[model samples]
Target: MQYKLITIEGNIGAGKTTLAKILSERLHGRLILESFEDNPFLPKFYKEPEKYSFPLELFFMAERFKQLQHSVNGPDLFHDTTISDYVFIKSLLFAKVTLAEDEYKLYKRLFHIINKQLPNPDILIYLHVPIQKLQKNIQTRDRSYEQSIPDEYLQKIQNTYLEYLKQSDQKVLFVEAENADFLTDSKHVDLILDALSKDYSPGKHYLQLS
Candidate 1:
Protein backbone atom coordinates (compact mmCIF):
# COMPACT_ATOMS: atom_id res chain seq x y z
CA MET A 1 0.00 0.00 0.00
CA GLN A 2 1.14 3.54 -0.67
CA TYR A 3 1.37 5.58 2.53
CA LYS A 4 0.18 9.18 2.60
CA LEU A 5 1.42 9.76 6.11
CA ILE A 6 4.29 7.83 7.71
CA THR A 7 5.43 8.42 11.31
CA ILE A 8 8.70 7.24 12.81
CA GLU A 9 8.62 6.71 16.57
CA GLY A 10 11.25 5.89 19.21
CA ASN A 11 12.79 6.95 22.50
CA ILE A 12 15.24 9.86 22.50
CA GLY A 13 18.56 8.98 20.83
CA ALA A 14 16.99 5.99 19.09
CA GLY A 15 17.49 7.83 15.77
CA LYS A 16 13.87 8.34 14.69
CA THR A 17 14.70 11.81 13.37
CA THR A 18 17.66 10.55 11.36
CA LEU A 19 15.67 7.75 9.75
CA ALA A 20 12.78 10.13 9.02
CA LYS A 21 15.14 12.47 7.17
CA ILE A 22 16.64 9.63 5.13
CA LEU A 23 13.27 8.11 4.31
CA SER A 24 11.85 11.47 3.29
CA GLU A 25 14.74 12.13 0.96
CA ARG A 26 14.72 8.65 -0.54
CA LEU A 27 10.94 8.46 -0.93
CA HIS A 28 10.55 12.09 -2.08
CA GLY A 29 8.16 12.76 0.80
CA ARG A 30 7.67 15.97 2.74
CA LEU A 31 9.24 15.83 6.22
CA ILE A 32 7.55 16.83 9.44
CA LEU A 33 10.16 16.96 12.21
CA GLU A 34 9.31 17.33 15.88
CA SER A 35 10.35 20.73 17.25
CA PHE A 36 12.23 19.47 20.27
CA GLU A 37 14.52 22.45 20.38
CA ASP A 38 11.59 24.82 20.50
CA ASN A 39 10.05 23.10 23.50
CA PRO A 40 10.74 25.29 26.56
CA PHE A 41 9.64 22.72 29.11
CA LEU A 42 11.97 20.03 27.78
CA PRO A 43 15.15 21.26 29.46
CA LYS A 44 13.41 21.82 32.78
CA PHE A 45 11.80 18.38 32.59
CA TYR A 46 15.15 16.77 32.14
CA LYS A 47 16.51 18.70 35.09
CA GLU A 48 13.56 17.79 37.34
CA PRO A 49 11.27 15.20 35.83
CA GLU A 50 8.90 14.94 38.81
CA LYS A 51 8.39 18.65 38.91
CA TYR A 52 7.98 19.30 35.20
CA SER A 53 6.75 16.07 33.64
CA PHE A 54 3.16 17.16 33.17
CA PRO A 55 4.02 20.47 31.58
CA LEU A 56 6.59 18.93 29.27
CA GLU A 57 4.21 16.20 28.16
CA LEU A 58 1.42 18.68 27.66
CA PHE A 59 3.60 20.91 25.55
CA PHE A 60 4.64 18.04 23.31
CA MET A 61 1.06 16.79 23.05
CA ALA A 62 -0.12 20.21 21.90
CA GLU A 63 2.75 20.64 19.47
CA ARG A 64 2.14 17.23 17.92
CA PHE A 65 -1.56 17.97 17.55
CA LYS A 66 -0.78 21.17 15.71
CA GLN A 67 1.66 19.36 13.46
CA LEU A 68 -0.85 16.61 12.68
CA GLN A 69 -3.48 19.20 11.84
CA HIS A 70 -1.08 20.98 9.52
CA SER A 71 0.03 17.75 7.87
CA VAL A 72 -3.54 16.91 6.99
CA ASN A 73 -4.47 20.41 5.82
CA GLY A 74 -1.18 21.69 4.41
CA PRO A 75 -0.02 21.40 0.82
CA ASP A 76 1.32 17.92 1.55
CA LEU A 77 -2.20 16.71 2.24
CA PHE A 78 -2.67 15.76 -1.43
CA HIS A 79 0.88 14.44 -1.80
CA ASP A 80 1.36 10.71 -2.17
CA THR A 81 3.75 10.54 0.81
CA THR A 82 4.85 12.43 3.93
CA ILE A 83 7.13 11.49 6.83
CA SER A 84 7.22 12.63 10.44
CA ASP A 85 9.90 12.02 13.07
CA TYR A 86 7.55 11.54 15.99
CA VAL A 87 4.08 10.06 16.50
CA PHE A 88 1.49 11.91 18.57
CA ILE A 89 0.82 8.90 20.79
CA LYS A 90 4.42 8.81 21.93
CA SER A 91 3.68 11.82 24.17
CA LEU A 92 1.15 9.77 26.12
CA LEU A 93 3.65 6.96 26.50
CA PHE A 94 6.18 9.39 27.94
CA ALA A 95 3.59 10.97 30.18
CA LYS A 96 2.64 7.58 31.60
CA VAL A 97 6.22 6.88 32.48
CA THR A 98 7.19 10.24 33.98
CA LEU A 99 4.14 11.97 35.43
CA ALA A 100 2.75 11.57 38.95
CA GLU A 101 -0.62 9.87 39.43
CA ASP A 102 -2.66 13.08 39.61
CA GLU A 103 -0.60 14.65 36.89
CA TYR A 104 -1.04 11.61 34.68
CA LYS A 105 -4.81 11.68 35.19
CA LEU A 106 -5.01 15.28 34.02
CA TYR A 107 -2.61 14.58 31.20
CA LYS A 108 -4.65 11.60 30.03
CA ARG A 109 -7.87 13.58 29.98
CA LEU A 110 -6.29 16.32 27.93
CA PHE A 111 -4.62 13.80 25.67
CA HIS A 112 -7.88 12.02 24.96
CA ILE A 113 -9.44 15.29 23.86
CA ILE A 114 -6.47 16.19 21.69
CA ASN A 115 -6.27 12.67 20.28
CA LYS A 116 -9.86 12.81 19.13
CA GLN A 117 -9.10 15.94 17.14
CA LEU A 118 -5.87 14.89 15.42
CA PRO A 119 -5.43 12.94 12.20
CA ASN A 120 -4.02 9.46 12.45
CA PRO A 121 -1.00 8.22 10.55
CA ASP A 122 -1.41 5.72 7.72
CA ILE A 123 1.70 3.88 8.98
CA LEU A 124 3.78 4.07 12.17
CA ILE A 125 7.35 2.77 12.34
CA TYR A 126 8.59 2.14 15.89
CA LEU A 127 12.31 1.89 16.49
CA HIS A 128 13.78 0.03 19.47
CA VAL A 129 17.26 -0.17 20.99
CA PRO A 130 18.71 -1.15 24.35
CA ILE A 131 19.00 1.44 27.10
CA GLN A 132 22.78 1.14 26.99
CA LYS A 133 22.74 1.82 23.28
CA LEU A 134 20.39 4.75 23.83
CA GLN A 135 22.67 6.16 26.50
CA LYS A 136 25.68 5.74 24.25
CA ASN A 137 23.89 7.50 21.45
CA ILE A 138 22.87 10.29 23.78
CA GLN A 139 26.42 10.74 24.96
CA THR A 140 27.70 10.78 21.40
CA ARG A 141 25.18 13.41 20.42
CA ASP A 142 26.05 15.50 23.50
CA ARG A 143 22.80 17.38 23.79
CA SER A 144 23.25 19.29 27.06
CA TYR A 145 19.67 18.82 28.19
CA GLU A 146 19.83 15.08 27.51
CA GLN A 147 23.04 14.49 29.42
CA SER A 148 21.14 14.29 32.69
CA ILE A 149 18.75 11.55 31.54
CA PRO A 150 19.14 8.47 33.74
CA ASP A 151 19.40 4.94 32.43
CA GLU A 152 16.40 3.89 34.51
CA TYR A 153 14.35 6.67 32.97
CA LEU A 154 15.42 5.64 29.49
CA GLN A 155 14.45 2.04 30.26
CA LYS A 156 11.02 3.11 31.48
CA ILE A 157 10.50 5.15 28.32
CA GLN A 158 11.55 2.23 26.12
CA ASN A 159 9.24 -0.18 27.97
CA THR A 160 6.36 2.23 27.58
CA TYR A 161 7.03 2.47 23.84
CA LEU A 162 6.94 -1.33 23.51
CA GLU A 163 3.69 -1.57 25.44
CA TYR A 164 2.08 1.28 23.51
CA LEU A 165 2.99 -0.23 20.15
CA LYS A 166 1.76 -3.64 21.24
CA GLN A 167 -1.68 -2.24 22.06
CA SER A 168 -1.98 0.38 19.30
CA ASP A 169 -4.63 -0.07 16.58
CA GLN A 170 -2.58 1.70 13.91
CA LYS A 171 -0.58 -0.21 11.30
CA VAL A 172 2.83 -0.46 13.03
CA LEU A 173 6.22 -1.54 11.77
CA PHE A 174 8.63 -2.43 14.57
CA VAL A 175 12.34 -2.17 13.83
CA GLU A 176 15.13 -3.20 16.19
CA ALA A 177 17.90 -0.62 16.05
CA GLU A 178 20.31 -2.89 17.88
CA ASN A 179 22.52 -3.10 14.80
CA ALA A 180 20.78 -1.15 12.09
CA ASP A 181 22.55 1.86 10.58
CA PHE A 182 19.71 3.68 8.89
CA LEU A 183 21.98 6.60 8.06
CA THR A 184 24.46 4.53 6.05
CA ASP A 185 22.63 1.42 4.91
CA SER A 186 20.56 1.28 1.72
CA LYS A 187 19.33 -2.20 2.61
CA HIS A 188 17.63 -0.87 5.74
CA VAL A 189 15.75 1.65 3.62
CA ASP A 190 14.66 -1.08 1.25
CA LEU A 191 13.39 -3.19 4.13
CA ILE A 192 11.28 -0.30 5.43
CA LEU A 193 9.87 0.40 1.96
CA ASP A 194 9.02 -3.27 1.51
CA ALA A 195 7.19 -3.33 4.83
CA LEU A 196 5.29 -0.17 4.01
CA SER A 197 4.19 -1.54 0.62
CA LYS A 198 3.11 -4.95 1.87
CA ASP A 199 0.09 -6.13 3.83
CA TYR A 200 1.42 -7.74 6.99
CA SER A 201 -0.10 -8.99 10.24
CA PRO A 202 -0.02 -6.76 13.29
CA GLY A 203 2.03 -7.43 16.48
CA LYS A 204 5.80 -7.21 16.90
CA HIS A 205 7.80 -8.01 13.76
CA TYR A 206 11.41 -7.50 12.61
CA LEU A 207 12.97 -6.84 9.24
CA GLN A 208 16.52 -8.00 8.69
CA LEU A 209 17.87 -6.05 5.78
CA SER A 210 20.32 -8.23 3.83
Candidate 2:
Protein backbone atom coordinates (compact mmCIF):
# COMPACT_ATOMS: atom_id res chain seq x y z
CA MET A 1 0.00 0.00 0.00
CA GLN A 2 2.95 2.32 0.44
CA TYR A 3 4.15 1.92 -3.14
CA LYS A 4 2.39 3.25 -6.16
CA LEU A 5 3.85 0.67 -8.53
CA ILE A 6 4.72 -2.96 -7.82
CA THR A 7 6.03 -5.75 -10.00
CA ILE A 8 5.44 -9.44 -9.48
CA GLU A 9 8.01 -11.62 -11.23
CA GLY A 10 8.94 -15.27 -11.28
CA ASN A 11 10.10 -18.02 -13.57
CA ILE A 12 7.69 -19.37 -16.20
CA GLY A 13 4.59 -20.88 -14.54
CA ALA A 14 5.37 -19.47 -11.12
CA GLY A 15 1.95 -17.84 -10.96
CA LYS A 16 3.06 -14.22 -11.32
CA THR A 17 0.23 -13.23 -13.63
CA THR A 18 -2.42 -14.69 -11.39
CA LEU A 19 -0.98 -12.98 -8.32
CA ALA A 20 -0.68 -9.68 -10.15
CA LYS A 21 -4.27 -9.83 -11.27
CA ILE A 22 -5.46 -10.62 -7.76
CA LEU A 23 -3.46 -7.75 -6.30
CA SER A 24 -4.72 -5.34 -8.93
CA GLU A 25 -8.30 -6.19 -8.18
CA ARG A 26 -7.90 -6.17 -4.39
CA LEU A 27 -6.14 -2.83 -4.42
CA HIS A 28 -8.21 -1.32 -7.22
CA GLY A 29 -5.04 -0.80 -9.23
CA ARG A 30 -4.36 -0.92 -12.94
CA LEU A 31 -2.89 -4.24 -14.05
CA ILE A 32 -0.37 -4.51 -16.86
CA LEU A 33 0.21 -8.10 -17.97
CA GLU A 34 2.96 -8.89 -20.43
CA SER A 35 1.55 -9.49 -23.92
CA PHE A 36 3.67 -12.38 -25.13
CA GLU A 37 0.84 -14.40 -26.64
CA ASP A 38 1.34 -12.78 -30.04
CA ASN A 39 5.11 -13.05 -30.21
CA PRO A 40 5.90 -14.94 -33.41
CA PHE A 41 9.31 -15.94 -32.17
CA LEU A 42 8.23 -17.49 -28.88
CA PRO A 43 7.10 -20.88 -30.15
CA LYS A 44 10.09 -21.04 -32.48
CA PHE A 45 12.47 -19.96 -29.77
CA TYR A 46 11.25 -22.68 -27.46
CA LYS A 47 11.54 -25.20 -30.26
CA GLU A 48 14.95 -23.94 -31.33
CA PRO A 49 16.51 -21.65 -28.74
CA GLU A 50 19.93 -21.51 -30.32
CA LYS A 51 18.54 -20.59 -33.69
CA TYR A 52 16.00 -18.02 -32.56
CA SER A 53 17.22 -16.62 -29.25
CA PHE A 54 18.47 -13.32 -30.56
CA PRO A 55 15.41 -12.29 -32.51
CA LEU A 56 13.10 -13.55 -29.80
CA GLU A 57 14.83 -11.49 -27.13
CA LEU A 58 14.98 -8.45 -29.37
CA PHE A 59 11.32 -8.54 -30.16
CA PHE A 60 10.46 -9.05 -26.51
CA MET A 61 12.57 -6.12 -25.39
CA ALA A 62 10.87 -3.84 -27.89
CA GLU A 63 7.40 -4.97 -26.89
CA ARG A 64 8.04 -4.72 -23.14
CA PHE A 65 9.44 -1.23 -23.49
CA LYS A 66 6.50 -0.11 -25.57
CA GLN A 67 3.94 -1.49 -23.13
CA LEU A 68 5.59 -0.11 -20.00
CA GLN A 69 6.09 3.28 -21.58
CA HIS A 70 2.41 3.69 -22.24
CA SER A 71 1.05 2.05 -19.11
CA VAL A 72 3.48 3.50 -16.59
CA ASN A 73 3.26 6.97 -18.04
CA GLY A 74 -0.46 6.92 -18.76
CA PRO A 75 -3.11 8.51 -16.56
CA ASP A 76 -3.78 7.08 -13.11
CA LEU A 77 -6.83 9.13 -12.17
CA PHE A 78 -8.90 6.03 -11.52
CA HIS A 79 -6.34 3.94 -9.67
CA ASP A 80 -3.86 4.55 -6.89
CA THR A 81 -1.63 1.59 -7.67
CA THR A 82 -0.18 -0.07 -10.76
CA ILE A 83 0.85 -3.70 -10.81
CA SER A 84 2.58 -5.61 -13.59
CA ASP A 85 3.31 -9.30 -14.02
CA TYR A 86 6.80 -8.55 -15.26
CA VAL A 87 9.59 -6.03 -15.06
CA PHE A 88 11.43 -5.16 -18.24
CA ILE A 89 14.63 -6.57 -16.70
CA LYS A 90 13.15 -10.01 -17.31
CA SER A 91 14.19 -9.70 -20.95
CA LEU A 92 17.79 -9.25 -19.93
CA LEU A 93 17.64 -12.13 -17.47
CA PHE A 94 16.18 -14.49 -20.03
CA ALA A 95 18.69 -13.29 -22.58
CA LYS A 96 21.51 -14.10 -20.19
CA VAL A 97 20.42 -17.69 -20.26
CA THR A 98 19.46 -17.93 -23.92
CA LEU A 99 21.89 -15.67 -25.76
CA ALA A 100 25.52 -16.14 -26.69
CA GLU A 101 28.16 -13.97 -25.04
CA ASP A 102 28.32 -11.50 -27.96
CA GLU A 103 24.55 -11.41 -28.25
CA TYR A 104 24.18 -10.81 -24.51
CA LYS A 105 26.58 -7.89 -24.65
CA LEU A 106 24.64 -6.26 -27.45
CA TYR A 107 21.36 -7.03 -25.71
CA LYS A 108 22.59 -5.51 -22.44
CA ARG A 109 23.42 -2.26 -24.15
CA LEU A 110 19.98 -2.06 -25.74
CA PHE A 111 18.34 -3.03 -22.46
CA HIS A 112 19.98 -0.23 -20.52
CA ILE A 113 19.15 2.34 -23.15
CA ILE A 114 15.43 1.55 -23.01
CA ASN A 115 15.36 0.59 -19.35
CA LYS A 116 16.52 3.93 -17.99
CA GLN A 117 13.53 5.59 -19.63
CA LEU A 118 11.02 3.40 -17.82
CA PRO A 119 9.82 3.72 -14.25
CA ASN A 120 11.28 1.33 -11.69
CA PRO A 121 8.87 -0.57 -9.50
CA ASP A 122 8.64 0.43 -5.87
CA ILE A 123 8.54 -3.22 -4.81
CA LEU A 124 9.49 -6.41 -6.65
CA ILE A 125 8.01 -9.66 -5.40
CA TYR A 126 9.63 -12.81 -6.75
CA LEU A 127 7.86 -16.11 -6.15
CA HIS A 128 10.41 -18.88 -5.64
CA VAL A 129 8.92 -22.30 -6.31
CA PRO A 130 10.84 -25.53 -6.77
CA ILE A 131 11.54 -26.56 -10.33
CA GLN A 132 9.35 -29.62 -9.93
CA LYS A 133 6.35 -27.53 -8.93
CA LEU A 134 7.04 -25.09 -11.71
CA GLN A 135 7.16 -27.91 -14.23
CA LYS A 136 3.80 -29.20 -13.06
CA ASN A 137 2.33 -25.72 -13.25
CA ILE A 138 3.61 -25.33 -16.80
CA GLN A 139 1.96 -28.58 -17.84
CA THR A 140 -1.27 -27.53 -16.16
CA ARG A 141 -1.23 -24.23 -18.06
CA ASP A 142 -0.80 -26.34 -21.21
CA ARG A 143 0.75 -23.83 -23.58
CA SER A 144 1.95 -25.88 -26.53
CA TYR A 145 5.22 -24.01 -27.02
CA GLU A 146 6.04 -24.31 -23.36
CA GLN A 147 5.38 -28.03 -23.41
CA SER A 148 8.75 -28.58 -25.03
CA ILE A 149 10.64 -26.65 -22.38
CA PRO A 150 12.95 -29.04 -20.65
CA ASP A 151 13.65 -29.05 -16.93
CA GLU A 152 17.29 -28.14 -17.60
CA TYR A 153 16.26 -24.95 -19.33
CA LEU A 154 13.94 -24.08 -16.48
CA GLN A 155 16.74 -24.67 -14.00
CA LYS A 156 19.05 -22.42 -15.95
CA ILE A 157 16.41 -19.70 -16.01
CA GLN A 158 15.82 -20.06 -12.27
CA ASN A 159 19.53 -19.73 -11.62
CA THR A 160 19.78 -16.63 -13.74
CA TYR A 161 16.83 -15.02 -12.00
CA LEU A 162 18.16 -15.78 -8.52
CA GLU A 163 21.61 -14.53 -9.44
CA TYR A 164 20.15 -11.29 -10.69
CA LEU A 165 18.11 -10.84 -7.53
CA LYS A 166 21.10 -11.57 -5.34
CA GLN A 167 23.06 -8.75 -6.97
CA SER A 168 20.26 -6.25 -7.53
CA ASP A 169 20.01 -3.17 -5.31
CA GLN A 170 16.28 -2.73 -5.82
CA LYS A 171 13.75 -3.37 -3.10
CA VAL A 172 12.65 -6.99 -3.41
CA LEU A 173 10.57 -9.44 -1.42
CA PHE A 174 11.60 -13.00 -2.14
CA VAL A 175 8.82 -15.44 -1.28
CA GLU A 176 9.41 -19.15 -0.88
CA ALA A 177 6.54 -20.82 -2.72
CA GLU A 178 6.95 -24.57 -2.35
CA ASN A 179 3.69 -24.86 -0.44
CA ALA A 180 2.01 -21.52 -0.91
CA ASP A 181 -0.36 -21.50 -3.83
CA PHE A 182 -1.90 -18.06 -4.02
CA LEU A 183 -4.63 -19.16 -6.39
CA THR A 184 -6.09 -21.76 -4.01
CA ASP A 185 -5.58 -20.36 -0.54
CA SER A 186 -6.69 -17.00 0.81
CA LYS A 187 -4.08 -17.18 3.57
CA HIS A 188 -1.30 -17.37 1.04
CA VAL A 189 -2.61 -14.28 -0.70
CA ASP A 190 -2.88 -12.51 2.61
CA LEU A 191 0.72 -13.34 3.40
CA ILE A 192 1.80 -11.70 0.16
CA LEU A 193 -0.31 -8.67 0.93
CA ASP A 194 1.15 -8.54 4.43
CA ALA A 195 4.61 -8.40 2.96
CA LEU A 196 3.62 -5.54 0.69
CA SER A 197 1.77 -3.60 3.36
CA LYS A 198 4.89 -3.23 5.47
CA ASP A 199 7.87 -1.01 4.74
CA TYR A 200 11.06 -2.32 3.22
CA SER A 201 14.19 -0.44 2.35
CA PRO A 202 16.31 -0.83 -0.76
CA GLY A 203 17.47 -4.37 -0.09
CA LYS A 204 16.38 -7.99 -0.38
CA HIS A 205 13.71 -9.26 2.01
CA TYR A 206 12.17 -12.67 2.63
CA LEU A 207 8.61 -13.96 3.00
CA GLN A 208 7.49 -17.52 3.64
CA LEU A 209 3.88 -18.50 4.16
CA SER A 210 3.32 -21.39 6.54
Candidate 3:
Protein backbone atom coordinates (compact mmCIF):
# COMPACT_ATOMS: atom_id res chain seq x y z
CA MET A 1 0.00 0.00 0.00
CA GLN A 2 1.24 3.48 -0.81
CA TYR A 3 -0.49 5.08 2.15
CA LYS A 4 0.41 4.61 5.80
CA LEU A 5 -3.05 5.23 7.22
CA ILE A 6 -6.16 3.59 5.74
CA THR A 7 -9.73 3.79 7.01
CA ILE A 8 -12.60 1.49 6.02
CA GLU A 9 -16.01 3.05 6.46
CA GLY A 10 -19.65 2.16 5.81
CA ASN A 11 -23.13 2.46 7.19
CA ILE A 12 -24.13 0.21 10.08
CA GLY A 13 -23.85 -3.52 9.25
CA ALA A 14 -21.92 -2.85 6.05
CA GLY A 15 -18.98 -4.94 7.37
CA LYS A 16 -16.51 -2.09 7.76
CA THR A 17 -14.93 -3.51 10.91
CA THR A 18 -14.48 -6.97 9.43
CA LEU A 19 -12.65 -5.59 6.41
CA ALA A 20 -10.49 -3.32 8.56
CA LYS A 21 -9.49 -6.19 10.84
CA ILE A 22 -8.61 -8.45 7.92
CA LEU A 23 -6.66 -5.72 6.13
CA SER A 24 -4.74 -4.76 9.27
CA GLU A 25 -3.61 -8.36 9.79
CA ARG A 26 -2.80 -8.93 6.14
CA LEU A 27 -0.82 -5.72 5.91
CA HIS A 28 0.84 -6.21 9.32
CA GLY A 29 -0.47 -2.82 10.42
CA ARG A 30 -1.83 -1.36 13.64
CA LEU A 31 -5.60 -1.71 14.08
CA ILE A 32 -7.75 1.03 15.60
CA LEU A 33 -11.28 -0.13 16.28
CA GLU A 34 -14.18 1.97 17.48
CA SER A 35 -15.44 1.44 21.03
CA PHE A 36 -19.14 1.88 20.37
CA GLU A 37 -20.03 -0.88 22.82
CA ASP A 38 -18.57 1.10 25.67
CA ASN A 39 -21.11 3.87 25.31
CA PRO A 40 -23.86 3.60 27.95
CA PHE A 41 -26.27 5.64 25.83
CA LEU A 42 -26.28 3.32 22.82
CA PRO A 43 -28.88 0.85 24.09
CA LYS A 44 -31.06 3.67 25.27
CA PHE A 45 -30.64 5.51 21.99
CA TYR A 46 -32.06 2.56 20.13
CA LYS A 47 -34.96 2.14 22.52
CA GLU A 48 -35.76 5.83 22.73
CA PRO A 49 -33.95 7.73 20.01
CA GLU A 50 -35.36 11.17 20.78
CA LYS A 51 -34.50 10.91 24.43
CA TYR A 52 -30.93 9.64 24.17
CA SER A 53 -29.64 10.52 20.69
CA PHE A 54 -27.81 13.68 21.71
CA PRO A 55 -26.06 12.07 24.65
CA LEU A 56 -25.14 9.03 22.61
CA GLU A 57 -23.60 11.13 19.85
CA LEU A 58 -21.82 13.35 22.36
CA PHE A 59 -20.23 10.39 24.10
CA PHE A 60 -19.09 8.91 20.80
CA MET A 61 -17.61 12.22 19.63
CA ALA A 62 -15.41 12.51 22.72
CA GLU A 63 -14.28 8.90 22.67
CA ARG A 64 -13.64 8.77 18.94
CA PHE A 65 -11.61 11.97 19.05
CA LYS A 66 -9.45 10.70 21.89
CA GLN A 67 -8.79 7.36 20.21
CA LEU A 68 -7.96 8.88 16.82
CA GLN A 69 -5.78 11.60 18.36
CA HIS A 70 -3.69 9.02 20.19
CA SER A 71 -3.41 6.61 17.30
CA VAL A 72 -2.84 9.13 14.51
CA ASN A 73 -0.49 11.42 16.44
CA GLY A 74 1.59 8.80 18.23
CA PRO A 75 4.94 7.60 16.97
CA ASP A 76 5.05 4.68 14.56
CA LEU A 77 7.03 1.65 15.69
CA PHE A 78 7.23 -1.70 13.91
CA HIS A 79 3.88 -1.16 12.23
CA ASP A 80 4.16 1.08 9.22
CA THR A 81 0.47 1.20 8.44
CA THR A 82 -2.59 1.98 10.57
CA ILE A 83 -6.08 0.72 9.71
CA SER A 84 -9.20 2.02 11.35
CA ASP A 85 -12.84 0.93 11.06
CA TYR A 86 -14.09 4.49 11.19
CA VAL A 87 -13.12 8.08 10.45
CA PHE A 88 -13.69 10.83 13.00
CA ILE A 89 -16.18 12.52 10.68
CA LYS A 90 -18.57 9.66 11.33
CA SER A 91 -19.72 11.46 14.46
CA LEU A 92 -20.92 14.40 12.42
CA LEU A 93 -22.57 12.16 9.80
CA PHE A 94 -24.56 10.28 12.39
CA ALA A 95 -25.38 13.40 14.33
CA LYS A 96 -26.76 15.02 11.19
CA VAL A 97 -29.46 12.39 11.15
CA THR A 98 -30.03 11.98 14.88
CA LEU A 99 -29.92 15.55 16.07
CA ALA A 100 -32.60 18.16 15.65
CA GLU A 101 -31.89 21.27 13.58
CA ASP A 102 -30.76 23.40 16.52
CA GLU A 103 -28.86 20.55 18.08
CA TYR A 104 -27.20 19.68 14.78
CA LYS A 105 -25.93 23.24 14.43
CA LEU A 106 -24.22 23.01 17.79
CA TYR A 107 -22.90 19.54 17.04
CA LYS A 108 -21.51 20.66 13.68
CA ARG A 109 -19.62 23.52 15.28
CA LEU A 110 -18.03 21.18 17.80
CA PHE A 111 -17.31 18.60 15.15
CA HIS A 112 -15.52 21.08 12.90
CA ILE A 113 -13.33 22.31 15.73
CA ILE A 114 -12.27 18.80 16.71
CA ASN A 115 -12.04 17.47 13.15
CA LYS A 116 -9.59 20.11 11.96
CA GLN A 117 -6.95 18.79 14.37
CA LEU A 118 -7.31 15.07 13.55
CA PRO A 119 -5.21 13.39 10.93
CA ASN A 120 -7.03 12.48 7.73
CA PRO A 121 -6.66 9.03 6.26
CA ASP A 122 -4.43 8.51 3.27
CA ILE A 123 -6.93 6.08 1.81
CA LEU A 124 -10.63 5.88 2.52
CA ILE A 125 -12.38 2.64 1.50
CA TYR A 126 -16.14 2.78 1.57
CA LEU A 127 -17.97 -0.55 1.34
CA HIS A 128 -21.31 0.05 -0.31
CA VAL A 129 -23.91 -2.53 0.62
CA PRO A 130 -27.57 -2.17 -0.25
CA ILE A 131 -30.09 -1.53 2.49
CA GLN A 132 -31.55 -5.03 2.26
CA LYS A 133 -28.12 -6.58 2.58
CA LEU A 134 -27.32 -4.33 5.52
CA GLN A 135 -30.52 -5.35 7.27
CA LYS A 136 -29.73 -9.00 6.71
CA ASN A 137 -26.28 -8.53 8.15
CA ILE A 138 -27.70 -6.77 11.15
CA GLN A 139 -30.10 -9.66 11.72
CA THR A 140 -27.29 -12.17 11.35
CA ARG A 141 -25.23 -10.28 13.93
CA ASP A 142 -28.20 -10.32 16.32
CA ARG A 143 -27.39 -7.36 18.47
CA SER A 144 -30.26 -6.58 20.87
CA TYR A 145 -30.27 -2.85 20.21
CA GLU A 146 -29.91 -3.26 16.47
CA GLN A 147 -32.76 -5.71 16.12
CA SER A 148 -35.50 -3.10 16.18
CA ILE A 149 -33.93 -0.59 13.82
CA PRO A 150 -36.40 0.50 11.18
CA ASP A 151 -35.54 0.58 7.51
CA GLU A 152 -36.19 4.30 7.40
CA TYR A 153 -33.65 4.99 10.10
CA LEU A 154 -30.96 2.88 8.49
CA GLN A 155 -31.66 4.42 5.09
CA LYS A 156 -31.27 7.90 6.51
CA ILE A 157 -27.86 7.08 7.93
CA GLN A 158 -26.72 5.45 4.70
CA ASN A 159 -27.80 8.48 2.74
CA THR A 160 -25.88 10.72 5.10
CA TYR A 161 -22.77 8.59 4.64
CA LEU A 162 -23.05 8.69 0.87
CA GLU A 163 -23.53 12.43 0.86
CA TYR A 164 -20.43 12.89 2.95
CA LEU A 165 -18.36 10.62 0.75
CA LYS A 166 -19.47 12.39 -2.40
CA GLN A 167 -18.09 15.72 -1.21
CA SER A 168 -15.05 14.43 0.72
CA ASP A 169 -11.56 15.45 -0.42
CA GLN A 170 -9.71 12.30 0.64
CA LYS A 171 -8.67 9.61 -1.82
CA VAL A 172 -11.72 7.35 -1.77
CA LEU A 173 -12.25 3.88 -3.19
CA PHE A 174 -15.92 3.04 -3.24
CA VAL A 175 -16.53 -0.69 -3.44
CA GLU A 176 -19.86 -2.22 -4.30
CA ALA A 177 -19.92 -5.16 -1.90
CA GLU A 178 -23.49 -6.37 -2.09
CA ASN A 179 -22.85 -9.64 -3.89
CA ALA A 180 -19.64 -10.95 -2.35
CA ASP A 181 -19.05 -12.52 1.04
CA PHE A 182 -15.47 -11.56 1.79
CA LEU A 183 -14.96 -13.79 4.82
CA THR A 184 -15.95 -16.99 3.02
CA ASP A 185 -14.38 -16.22 -0.31
CA SER A 186 -10.69 -15.42 -0.53
CA LYS A 187 -11.28 -14.16 -4.08
CA HIS A 188 -13.26 -11.28 -2.68
CA VAL A 189 -10.31 -10.23 -0.57
CA ASP A 190 -8.06 -10.44 -3.59
CA LEU A 191 -10.42 -8.21 -5.51
CA ILE A 192 -10.41 -5.57 -2.78
CA LEU A 193 -6.65 -5.79 -2.44
CA ASP A 194 -6.29 -5.21 -6.15
CA ALA A 195 -8.40 -2.08 -5.89
CA LEU A 196 -6.38 -0.75 -3.00
CA SER A 197 -3.10 -1.39 -4.81
CA LYS A 198 -3.79 1.02 -7.61
CA ASP A 199 -2.92 4.71 -7.29
CA TYR A 200 -5.90 7.04 -7.03
CA SER A 201 -5.87 10.81 -6.97
CA PRO A 202 -7.34 13.09 -4.33
CA GLY A 203 -10.96 12.38 -5.26
CA LYS A 204 -13.56 9.63 -5.26
CA HIS A 205 -12.73 6.49 -7.25
CA TYR A 206 -14.97 3.43 -7.56
CA LEU A 207 -14.47 -0.32 -7.85
CA GLN A 208 -17.12 -2.98 -8.22
CA LEU A 209 -16.99 -6.75 -7.62
CA SER A 210 -17.35 -8.42 -10.97
Best by lDDT: 2
lDDT of 3: 0.90
Worst 10 residues of 3 by lDDT: 179-188
Candidate 3 ranges beyond 4 A from true positions: none
lDDT per residue (tens digit) for residues 1-210 in model 1: 477888888888989898999988878888899887888998888788778888788888888888778775577544468899987778888888988888889998988987887778887888888888889899999999999788899988888888777687777888877777877787887888878887766555666544
lDDT tens per residue, model 3, 49-96: 999999999999999999999988999888989999998989999999
lDDT of 2: 0.92
Write the number of the candidate with greater lDDT, choosing between 1 and 2: 2
Query: Where does model 2 exceed 4 Å of error?
Result: none
Assess every candidate by TM-score.
0.92, 0.97, 0.97
- Compared with the true structure, all predictions reach lDDT values of 0.82, 0.92, 0.90
Candidate 3, residue 172: Cα displacement in angstroms equals: 0.6
The CA lDDT at 107 in model 2 is 95
Stretches off by above 4 angstroms in model 1 are 75-78
Worst 10 residues of 2 by lDDT: 177-186
Query: Tens-digit lDDT track for model 2 on 1-210?
Result: 799999999999999999999999889999999999868999999878899999999999999999999999888789999999999999999999999999999999989988999989999999999899999999999998888788999899999999999999999999998787777798998988888989898889998876
